[model samples]
Target: MYLGLDLGTSGLKAVLIDDDQQLLGEAMSALTVQRPHSGWSEQNPADWLVAAEEVMAALGVAHDLGAVQGIGLSGQMHGATLLDAAGDVLRPCMLWNDTRSHAEAAAMDADPKWRAISGNIVFPGFTAPKVEWVREHEPEIWSRIDKVLLPKDYLRYWLTGEAVSEMSDAAGTSWLDTGERDWSDALLAASGLSHEAMPRLVEGSHVSGHLRDDLAKRWGLKKGVIIAGGAGDNAAAAVGMGVVTPGQAFLSLGTSGVLFAASGAYQPDAPSAVHTFCHALPDTWHQMGVILACTDALNWYAQLVHSDAVTLTQGLGPLQAPSETLFLPYLGGERTPYNDAAARGAFLGLGHATNSSAGARAVLEGVSYAFADCHDALSSTGTQIGSLVAVGGGSKSAYWLELLATVLDMPIHVPEAGDFGGAFGAARLAQMAVTGGGASLATPPRTERTIAPRTDLQAAFAEGHARYKRSYHALKEAL
Candidate 1:
């Protein structure tokens, strides 16, 4: 048996699988994000540990964890978790969605070396800027920092008592030489850091360390079970969905929206705000266009109307033409194409005729248009996405998927229902770590059905999308 632990923004999940890669059992524990100040998002590292232990205990209650031979971890990328030499957390981790470091990010982005070396824009949520933010605002905490680890690496340290990170996660830190797949001394120096303050690097599929004896005994696992260097969430999702080959793509509609495509080469289009990061596997890379909000916007509106996303989306009828009402799903700024941390969300074209349903539909369309922008950004990089497999909480809504299909003018595949997410992908990595297998083991799941673009609504959506694009530029100054 093998174990995969995914420490997500909202929860920590544990999945158990056998040598054949079939999931035997799984458990999850919830976590919460604390936004003490505007534009900032954080979580206690202790909370992550608590959630991890909760899931493991729950899984142990029902499964034979003693047979577990390997463990893998996956988590949200770009979170800055600081540690002292004694291995104590210095403060709450600054998460990927936090935009508190916009000024720092802008300053770093101005330095061409950052883009040249990292192959990414210095977005506020990236780890480097977050570290810089602490340096400028919380110098006392910064002074004692001995190491900076991404979210998952912190969890890995708890499990194995080691500070380790992999290519996929490190690529987001703006301190990595993406093409070379190693830390860049100049970039680290620019951030007032060095190699000594960073975790040791490894490939996602390789074994990084072994589980600690005390924890292993408590969790009913072998003391020295190998732990794989797992991936960032999206890269892990790609592994779970078998999107390792060049041109294979997946669209994620979680808290954020992402259009991710695997690439065989290190193609950087930093100016376009398309993220070029190493894939979970060695000698591979992926490019992604990101929008800061997706289901988050939906949930925002749901809260306004005192309804849930499922009910709100379910209340709507058949997919209709683009609503006269429009929304910009920039609830927490944006990433791809614009990289505007100060940009705010707005609901345009609202009139007396606009009701709750129309507002909800507008929210959905706005998100679709945001994705259309992402698609265009990727297209500009000459990255062709033949089709996209839909994943995340928002993908559960058929109406939203149909509308997204119409807006993108491309087919969207929905995989058979199961836990083909970060945790499952991490399990696959664990399997690879133990068995010495590679891409061949990462097979795509069976497609349950496909949602094809509505040819009938093609021209209408084109016009709607054009208007949507125009609204952003026209309202940029005011919004």
Candidate 2:
């Protein structure tokens, strides 16, 4: 048996897979994010430990933990989890959706060399800017910091007593030279960090350390279980969905929206807000575009209307007509193509006659247009994205997926593995790690169904998107 763990912003998930590449057991424990100020998202690292322990114990009830030979991890990327010499968390993790570091991001982005080396315009969500923000705003904490680690690496330290991170998660720090697949000294210095602040780097399939003897005995497992270097959530999800090949891509509509595609070499359009990062694998890279909000917009609207997404979108008709209302899903500020951390969401053309259904569909359609914008920008990054796989809570909505397909004018593949998210990918990586990178030992995920675009609706969505673009810029200017 092998174990894969994912420490997500929403929860901790543990998956136990058999040697046959089948999921034998799985469990999850929910978590909460703290918002002390607007546009700021934080989570206590202690909560992650508690939740992870819950999930692992739950999984143990269903499977024999003693048989586990290896473990892998996956997590939300770019969170700043500062630590001291004794390996204690110094502050609540500043999450990827947090935009409090906008000024620092702007400072780094002003340098062309920073952009050229990192292959991304520094966004407040990336790890590097958060470090700069903390250094300037909380000098006391900064002075005490002995190491800075991403969220998953913090957990890895807890499980294995190892301070390490892999390439894919490290790339989000804006401290990595994407082409070289290594940390950039100049970028780290610009971000107020040195090489010493970072943990050692490894490929996702490489054995980074062994599980602690105490942890092994407590969990009914043997000591020396190999821990494989893991991946950022998006990359791990892609691995789960089998989006390893160049033409393969996927749209993740979680707390943030991500459009990701793998590449054989580094391909970047940093100046245009496309994210270029190393793939979890040793010899690959990926291009991605992120929008700060996606289904979270729907969730927001649901709360306002005192309804849920399923009820709000339940009987809404046809993809072509969402509503006269146009929503800009910049609730957490924008990313792809704009990188406007100060941008705010809006509802345009709302009429007294408009009902909740129309409003719900409008929120979804507007997000679809945002995704369309990301798709175009990613294509400009020189990757010819083929069919896109749809994952995340938002992808569960059939109505929303249809709108996305029409607006993007591309089919969206729904695979059985979508529900597993990154946890399954970590398990797959663990399997590969134990087997010495043997590709033939892994099983490809099965497709649930495909949602194809209606060419008729594409023209209508194009018209809607033009109006959305205009309203979006006008709103930004007004702000």
Clashes of each: 0, 0
lDDT of 2 by residue, 11-70 (tens): 998888888767888898999989999989999999998988898789778777999989
lDDT of 1: 0.92
Candidate 1 has its poorest 10 consecutive residues by lDDT at: 434-443
Q: State the displacement of the C-alpha of residue 413, model 1, in Å, after optimal TM-score superposition.
A: 0.7
lDDT of 1 by residue, 124-169 (tens): 9999999999999999999999999999999999989999999999
lDDT of each: 0.92, 0.86
lDDT of 2: 0.86
Q: Number of the top candidate by lDDT? A: 1
Residue 443 error, candidate 1, Å: 1.3
TM-score of each: 0.98, 0.97
